[model samples]
Target: MAEKPGLVKTRQERVETRLRQRQVYNERMSKKRRARPRSLNIGDVVLMKNRRPGSKFKTRFESGMWAVTRVKGTLVTVTKGDEVVTRNISCFKRYHGAPADHQESGNNSDHEEGECEFGRVGGTAEHWLASGNLQMGEGLAAQKTTTPGSPVPNQDDVPAEAPAEGSNSEATRRSGLGRYNLRSRLTLPERLRDYVCE
Candidate 1:
């Protein structure tokens, strides 16, 4: 059989071109594979991906966030109450805000554990904050009175008067239909003189 001119050359060229294209494609994919996944340290908060198909309107993530107790390779461990679960790294979505109360306990042991965790305990500051007595800004504590007359209310609004037994004024105020007449003087009608006498 006579060899065709340029057939071998063209075939060699086509094979070489295919090899080069494949190498380029592989290099691009390798670079992408080398790209780092999101790093989740211990104590990080994460929302787990719920594999169970929920209603179309329901969210993909699990309800409430879970705190990362341990991370091993591509797996993460999360706890809820006494229940613990280990899931693949791909199954979790990073939580951006403050973590739940579980993470707060880890904050106290941060020094011992050599890692600072997010969240805080319910301390005196938090108590005062809840009670709404915590004052902020400069001069807030220094200012004794909110206005000219009223103080910051360290004590009761009305001062404790003497017991009703000994004082004549207290006895009269209590004995008089001051007890029975619940209506204030300002509310009394001006034309009720005849009714008052009756």
Candidate 2:
């Protein structure tokens, strides 16, 4: 009966030691881990992670935006149009803009009038090029000519000049093969230069 008290004391000591070790391990791991965002709420917009197989250039999140309908602890329920999905908060990234409903209704006055859903003030890249607002190899030139407060000039107003004769810039821009061609002109090693074909 006297040995029972000693055994209980030893077991208590071991349990206390293990608890201390566990606490230390948890503190170390918490420092390396990223804190989850706790500001998520209903009506907030967020983008869900995309798991589809794609090239390296593909976006990490889906293009379609989802609005948070319900937030239950770590799980968030989102809806995009007719589609509804419930996923963990870790799978979502908070979107920083007005909700789609406000944007569609034109109730958001922060955006310019007639701004496209994609946020382009004007039309597409082709439209900009056709309007002579943009040109090949002259994007920087246009920016340079305009002062900080001055408006950009139309490319149509200024005549286009032909590139200098024998200039490799145009060739390099048209085909990447020109850059590789320069490697062939490098002098061969001394040992390889002495060998001549019959």
Best by lDDT: 2
lDDT of 1 at 77: 90
Which residue pairs show backbone clashes in model 1? none
Residue-level lDDT of model 1, residues 120-181, one tens digit each, is 33222222223333222333332433442233454577587776664556566676555444
lDDT, residue 59, model 1: 71
Task: Give the poorly placed runs of model 1, Cα more than 4 Å off.
Answer: 1-30, 33-35, 99-198
Q: For each candidate, what TM-score against the reference?
A: 0.37, 0.45
What's the CA RMSD for each of the models? 17.2, 11.6
Encode model 2's per-residue lDDT on 1-198: one tens digit a residue: 456655555777999999999999988787779554477777666778986748888878886667677889999998766578999888898765332222244344655566543223342323222233221234334445654334566769888988776456767645645555554566778888887533
In angstroms, the error of model 1 at 128 is: 19
User: Which residue runs does candidate 2 get wrong by more than 4 Å?
Assistant: 1-32, 98-184, 191-198
For candidate 2, list the clashing residue pairs, or say none: none
